[model samples]
Target: MAHTQKLEMLERDDYLRFRLPEALKERFKLYCYLKGITMSDTVREMIEEVLKNEDLEKLLQEKLLQEKQRENSRDETDD
Candidate 1:
C-alpha cells in the first residue's frame, strides 16, 4: 500500500478578473445562483465544452495548415 502513494507537485489556481455591464453582471450572478453553481464553474464548463467540439477542432487545424502554407508562399516571394 505504501508503494501506491505517488508524489505530486502542488498546483496553484490562477485568477482572471474582468468587468461586464452592470445589468449583465447582475443577471449572470443571479442565474448562477439559481442554478446552484459558482460563476467560475459555469464559465469553465462552457470553455471546456467549446474546446472539446470536434468540428471546431477540425476548423482550427485547417486554419493552421492554411496559415503555414501562406507563410511558405510569402517566403518563396521573398527569395
Candidate 2:
C-alpha cells in the first residue's frame, strides 16, 4: 500500500527540462557521480534550498519590479 502511494506521488511530479553549457554539464555529472547521488536528486535538493531562501524571493521581486519600470519608461518614451 505504501509502495503504491509512493509511485502515485512520483507519477504526479512534473518533469523539468533545461539546457546547460557542455563543460558545466560534465562537471555537474562528475560531482554527482563522486557524491554517489543521482543528478536529478542533486538538482532537486538545490532547487529546494533556493526556494527556502527568503533573500531569493526578495531579489526576484526586485528584478520583476525593475523590469516593469523599464517597460513603463519605454512606453512613455514611445508616446
Candidate 3:
C-alpha cells in the first residue's frame, strides 16, 4: 500500500497578480519551479538581492577610499 501526500491549497484572491510578457512569465515560472519556490517568493528574493548588492557596493567604495589614504600615508612617510 502506498501513502498519499496531502497538499494545501492557497487561496488565489489572497495573493496579488500582475501581467507580464508571455515568454518572460513562462521562463520565470520554470525557474521558480526548479528552485522549489513560488513566483512571489522568487521575486521577493530578487529584490532583496538588489538591495543587498547596493549596500555591498557602498561598503566597497568606503574600503577603497581607506586603502588609498593608507597608500598616501606610506608615500609621505617614505619621502
| Candidate with best TM-score | 2
In model 1, the runs with Cα more than 4 Å from the true position are: 1-11, 54-79
Tally clashes: model 1: 0
Better of 1 and 3 by TM-score: 1
The 10-residue segment of model 1 with minimum total lDDT is 1-10
Summarize candidate 3's per-residue lDDT along 1-79 as a digit string, tens digits. 2233222233233555778999999998999899899998888778779887687878899999999999999999999
Best by lDDT: 2
Q: Give the Cα-based TM-score of candidate 2 against the true structure.
A: 0.65
* lDDT for each candidate structure: 0.85, 0.93, 0.81
- Residues 1-79, model 1: lDDT tens digits: 3433432223345688888999998899999999999999998889889878758777989999999999999999999
Estimated TM-score for each candidate: 0.55, 0.65, 0.43
Candidate 2 segments exceeding 4 Å error: 1-11, 55-64
Predicted structure 3: lDDT: 0.81
Error of 2 at 40 (Å): 0.5
Candidate number with the higher lDDT (1 or 3): 1
Q: In what order do the candidates fall by lDDT, top score first?
A: 2, 1, 3
